[model samples]
Target: MSEAVQIASIKDDGAIPVYVARPAAAPKGAIIVIPEIFGVNPGIRQKCDKWAANGYLAVAPDIFWRFAAGVELDPDIEAQLNQAFGYFQQYDPADGVYDIESTIRWIRQDAGAIKVGCAGYCLGGRLAYMAAARTDVDASVGYYGVMIDTMLDEAHRIANPLMLHIACEDQFVSAQAQAAVHAGLDGHPRVTLYDYPGMPHGFAAEMGDRRHAAEAELADARTEAFLAEHLA
Candidate 1:
């Protein structure tokens, strides 16, 4: 089951709207599911629901609340797509990381969670990478995270486990960016990088035309195992 809730944010003491999903029984751990620039829509909520069903407490924060609160836009919709990008252009990753840090604290200190992991998609994927580098989150995963190669300088600060899914042919992410990400992250003991040869951005989306079922399943299985190992 899922509910809409608000959590305390360190930035300006604002309330970060969140979509929370709790397991039927006691949760084994907690996961913060970050959303794309499109906001905490159906696809993002479904992710939390799946995690909750699998016995993890899941929360997705509205990191875009400062700009647009409770906004759900479809990437496939032309007008919404442009609106989403406009919000994306204004988003600051540093702020997103702080919001993630607050979520981590709430999970551990307030929610009594033993361990916390985070999985992010698209814009969220980028935030997940930042959380891995900048927060106390125990584990982090990113699917088609954008601009990760630019922030690799912070990779040295990653103290816990991190798994990243890269869509090799992602239209939003250039081949050079992919190459840079590989060069920066490959062989990093704490980070695991997986490349999807023919996939594009949002290939693992819970819904919509972008989802590639087979590849999503493979990546999700890998993600689940990674979370289990580290969060355990």
Candidate 2:
């Protein structure tokens, strides 16, 4: 259902490698799967597959290809986690969002997709929020997105449906940040926010210690329903 593919990068003459998944039946729409700090690893690929199984064309781009390609880090490994954080420190979300914007354009023009949405995790979650405001993505969803509070000024640019899943006890995000997020966009007519009371930062991860089974399931179910409703 999924395979490695390439998308043309308008900024350059090269092709960007991407993991693409297609549904068994005709796709209802396309969902771009934005990866966490770990890049396009197995977990991220699985996310694309999950979306494909749900009747969407799922595409995951390598946002770190500007500096590194084929990155697959494990959070449980001390060294890898540190390396991931290092990459995070070096990554500029503005550049990453540009890649996301190109991906959306490719999905629409090259892939023949009628509707395109985005679902992002961790750092990707922040990009999802940006996409809601900056791109033509039909709908956007973010899970425990870090640093979103700092970009609240751009909330007025969000013209489509946007959703966010917040882990109430996320170690990476502070109480003040969460409150700011709520205060800034809680009343936005096109936005919906969900809070998971006892979840941690990566509670919805596909595997490992960060995965909180029940909470992840609940959030994913909500995401699927939201995507189906909006993209359809």
Candidate 3:
């Protein structure tokens, strides 16, 4: 079983709310799980629990708390999407990276983890890459990150191990963008990219009917293996 705890973030200008999930036993490592623009919804919480089940202390910070507190998007497709995209534009990626780094530091100090990694979905996924570029994370896993192409120029500077899971049929991310990211990391031995054919943007989200069971399972296994190898 996993336990949920509330953590406070440093007040730069305001307070940030963070939710942490961990197993009863000592953690092997710590993971800073970043959430999508919808904030730390049930799906994100499940992701944290999944990580905790794998022996890592997982913490997810409310990235949108600065804009709105405890946001939960409606299940209606159009409404949910509008809310998700709306928050995405309101918060800058730099802020997300800083908040994530803060969460990482908090976990390192409170949980006493030796190594740390990051995993995120959608907007969080893109932020995962940015966190890896800016912070000292042991590993990073990005699932269908949209803005990764824009940061290709800085890819060579990334020293941490990075893994990207891309949805080949995703309308939001174009082939050109994927190519740019690949080209940027072409010779980088620390980066690995995988494309899931026919999978949508939030395929790994189990709460929705869009969940691709096989694909999600495969990605989960891959993510676990990557974290175990790097953080263990």
lDDT of each: 0.93, 0.91, 0.82
Weakest 10 consecutive residues of candidate 1 by summed lDDT: 105-114
Q: lDDT tens digits, residues 34-67, model 2?
A: 9999999889998999889888999999988878
**C-alpha lDDT (0 to 100) for residue 71 of candidate 3:** 86
Kindly list the per-residue Cα lDDT of model 1 for residues 157-226, writing each as its tens digit: 9999999999999999999999999999997999999999999999999999999999999999999999
Tell me the spans in candidate 3 whose CA falls farther than 4 Å from its real position: 1-11, 74-76
Rank the models by TM-score, top first.
1, 2, 3
Highest lDDT against the true fold, candidate: 1
Tell me how many residue pairs clash in candidate 3. Answer: 0
Model 3 lDDT-worst window of ten: 2-11
- What C-alpha lDDT does candidate 2 achieve relative to the native structure? 0.91
On the 0 to 100 scale, the lDDT of residue 190 in model 3 is 90
- TM-score of candidate 3 relative to the true fold: 0.94
